[model samples]
Target chain A: MAKVPVQFTLNGSEKAEFIDSGTTLLHALRDKIGDTSPKGGCHQGTCGACSVIVDGELRLSCLTLAETCNGATITTTSGLAEGGVLHPLQRAFLDTFATQCGFCTPGMIMAAKVLLDHTPNPSREDVVEALSGNICRCTGYEPIIQAVLTAARGNSQNAA
Target chain B: MAIRRGRGVAAINYPTGMNLGGDPTQALVHSTPTGNFMVTLSSVDLGQGMKQIMAQICAETIGVPTDCVVVDTADTDTGPHCMGTFASRGTHRAGNAVIQAAKEARQVMLEVAAEELEVNASDLETDGQGNILVKGAPQKSISIFDVALSAHFKRGRSISGRGMFLIPRSYPEKETGAMKPSTCYAHACTVAEVEVDDETGEVTVLTVKNVFEIGRALNPKMVEQQLVGGSWMGISHALYETTEPYYPNRDHGGTDFNQYLMPGPGDLAETEIIVLERPSADGPYGAKGPGEMCANPQIPAVANAVFDAVGVRVDTLPITPERILRALKAQAN
Candidate 1:
């Protein structure tokens, strides 16, 4: 396969890479940058597990060709945490047992973060609308919804 | 000498927003032969956290940290083959086993303590730390480890325990000729309200409520989480999934998560879980199976919700708007 040069900012860092047309942004993020937080669930963009924010809009990385990134900043789930401590959303998820298999967590959290960033104090309906793209097989949305609400309430986290 | 056997039972709870239709029953027992205690289960975790619930049951029954009680998974190699793990039978069945095993271990400890301390078995009490205390004297004590060590070294004996349980069967009112003691039932009711686009037939689940009657809750948080996830799976099955038909002409196709349309976050209604606790006679800590029971109602609930919104009842699953629109057009003609 022929190769193409691509440049994109990952998690607020500058990066330049060369990849073939068939190489997806997900592949570059996972294989090249070695960030495994954004999972590859449905490479066809149906399963939103590979969703990422491109220039502040939620986009499916699997569907986007690597060459199209070209100097765009890509933020993944790894960037959600600070210095080994979990993000508030991650902590809330654990406390409320929102995450079960954890396969959809990174994307779910990313999508939720985008919503929260835009609407800091979103209503329950807003949270639902924001997370509609992610999928979790365990912890029905009840616990997850509660966790997001709890995080918004300033509850202490890191409890097992 | 604590062989308490009781009839298993089931109860139902319907949430304000949702209606449910299913039955699940579970039982558990704990026993001790010598002093070695083991926790066993017929429930499969499937990464759903059943193992943790089993450990918690042991810890609560025997009074130890959940981590202290080791879990043994489904093994036909072990004695007493269970019905297998699909119906949330772990805490109910395995929990009872842990209780029986822990009680047996406790008996051995009491006997040894009574002999060494020159006190009657009735006069001894187990401290929360699995230690034996001589009632009035707080300082004169022995840990479970000490008792286990004594039984192994000084007494030249070993302690062991076992447990067994089974759920009562349901559907057919009374078991007549071929009835084996299948006496456990867990009930749930789920409701969903939805909005469907008349043009595209894209049905959006607006809200969902699940109300269940579990005999007991080992961990309420975990139970609620699993139920929610399960509801989503059911909703996915009802509205978005397509299965390849075995018949020559039908359209049955797809492989794995890629081709299949499982319910993403977008497909789910804002879910609410209402847990109703009504302890069963046979379950451990009054705990019953609640895992698979919730999934059953979610499908029908979504289907009904779509009907409420668009006045079109979807008999078949994966009720896409395309199908709904087609149904509407067919009705118009």
Candidate 2:
């Protein structure tokens, strides 16, 4: 194993870290940056638990080699809420009870965010299509779909 | 291009809690100087909202608001004994224990409030909103917080209570092997509508409608989430997952989920759930548990639907397209 220096912006902060060559971005974020919000569900990229926004694109952090993302920006679930105010998707997820176990939540939320960014007000079918990559064992897909649909309707989040 | 649709229904019942004596869970409730109460348990949440459910029980029992009760679980060293969180026992078993503990603690609270107000302990009643008021005089009241301070400092009595709930064992009858298994049983029924392609043998689930009689839904939102998650799991088990003859024939089989099929978001169907409340006589707040029963009915419902659609009975798990085609061919022959 060889350690390599990689530089990138994590949650809007500049960071440079040394990691082994075979390290996945999920490990880099969790092991190096100490951000455990991005989960390591299935390292083969099938389970979207390790979802991260890389340069404004939702990518599975487990499949992406840390060294390959040397100069890119990364956003994990930790960065979704700004200044203690949760994003609409995050709020909707809580309100709709979209999260259960929360292991796959960050990825699911990231996946839904990309869809809303592309289509501000997507139909139910569109929400389903965007969530194809993410898998949630709890709350089924209906709650997540409803949460995303609610967020798309310009409804403000009310966290309880 | 010939797609045929059919509907099928299934009903199932499951017992709550483990069926053995000494399957006990202990709860410890102690009041804080800030007038809030903390409950400690050894049962794990496993993301099932056990902590929240326990908090709700404690709040109601102690006559405090739901927010004033905090639950801390899964510290094996510090927390008391718990039989774990499975068997849908978090609500029925552990919840019963919490109710007992909070009730004991509330007795002391009323006593202290009585002494401070110069009234009989029986005359003081909790408003269930963090206040102790005299019966028939709602306007005359003192906050539970101030009374907690008096109990801790002036009266010098510890405001803490411990509780444990255990089920008794019943001897089975010699002839029938029948005995009490659980304190209560939860029932569910599901109807699944699916479409099958006559040519390709591909099956598409369209909708799932369900009704559950879970005694009483302790937390209605959490109950709904459980049902929704369970329905998909049933779909995955019935139609997508498989581990079969390929293992001995091939050295390496589908090792991960990519090779082992599971349903994704694209495969999700419309879901409608109806919850019926039938209060349990013994359960805390007339509530029973609804954990594993969530996924039981979905499996057979889909299988029955496929049979209804193609007039072929494929009695196998993961009712794959290959199996459906094979069954269709056999029926044609």
Candidate 3:
């Protein structure tokens, strides 16, 4: 297979990589750009472990073509932190013990970030719906929901 | 199309560690030059918080803060021997090994502190706050950091220890096929409530309440994680999951997550867990294994709940809508 060139902004940094013609964004990001935070739980896009934000919309990177994402601004779990400060979702995950095996944490956090960005004061049901796409075998989904709720409450308090 | 509600309960006693040719695990503990402890083992964590719990056990045994201890595992070349991480043996077997290793390393740490304080090793006591103080006088004390510095630069002694734990093998009688399978046992009981739709033959688990008697909760949060997640797995196995829809025919097995059904977060039922600690005599810090047992009783409990709901028995796993419908049809006939 012939290799193709693709360029995109990843986690605020401009990264250009050469990939196979049919390479997925997940493969491009992990293998080509070396940003391995996006885990590939299922290449079939069933498990949301490869979730990433492309142009402000959540897309399963494993199912997305890298060439289609040209000039797109991508956000991942690695981009959530700034200047050595953890994102509210990240901090809440640690504080609430939302992670265990942690393979699903990146995608779960990314999904929660999208939810909080749109609905800053989400309810417990909202958190559950947002994270339902991601599969976490270790946490039983309760702690992750609690962490999302905690993050939303923290964000609301900060605004107040 | 009416929904019938019913409840069922189950109790189980799960073995902690298998007695297969003397289940054994080894650990190596050594103090760094800065007085921090490193525990080395080949045991894998498997997301069960093995590393974190091992660090806690090592810190407690060495009388040091947990933050000062680091657990490095699963490097067979550098790490010590382990009998794998299955059969719920990581906490019971590897934990005891880590405790033994930490004790020996703690002995050397105290000896070094004793030399600096000009007191006998027997008279020295660790304050659990990085200080080694005399038994009678707390004023005369040496920091573990200073003790490590002296042991490394001045005393020229290496503070290290190796430990291994082995369970005695119990052989089965040839005719009777009976033996002591494990050293310690963890018990649990689960009460599962479900609503069954007679028309659709769909079972919706309403709630799962359970009590576990795990010898001790080394880390309550980790134990809770296992129990909660394990119960979810049990629910999945009871209703949604099946690799072979038609067993003995390898034609249509699920190849991925899409085909293999699992209960999503939205499908989760209300779960309540109560942990009971009955400390074991031989366990490390009286901790037994709660890894695999947390998923056991819920399988039967769910199966029984389905039987109670519609008064029809579905003997096979993953009490699917089809199975329930078939059983109801057979009952009607």
Q: Please, what is the TM-score per model?
A: 0.70, 0.93, 0.97
Query: Compared with the true structure, what per-residue lDDT tens digits does model 2 show for residues B82-192?
Result: 888888888888889999999889898888888998889899888888899999987878998899899988998777889999887777899999988877888899999
Q: Candidate 1 lDDT, tens digit per residue, B137-177?
A: 86887776667677777775545555554333424346554
B139: Cα error in model 2, Å: 4.2
Q: TM-score of model 3 relative to the true fold?
A: 0.97
Q: What local distance difference test score does each model get?
A: 0.68, 0.87, 0.91
Least well predicted 10-residue stretch by lDDT in candidate 2 chain B = B245-254
Model 3, B213: alpha-carbon shift in Å? 0.8
Tell me, by lDDT, which candidate is best.
3
**Tens digits of lDDT, candidate 3, A36-137:** 999989898899999999988888999999999889999999998999999999999988888888999999998998899899999888988998888878
Which residue pairs in candidate 3 have backbone atoms (N, alpha carbon, C) closer than 3 angstroms, thus clashing?
Answer: none
Q: Which candidate number would show the highest TM-score if scored against the true structure?
A: 3
Residue B101, model 3, lDDT: 93
Q: Rank the candidates by lDDT, best first.
A: 3, 2, 1
Candidate 2's TM-score: 0.93
Complex DockQ per candidate: 0.40, 0.74, 0.74
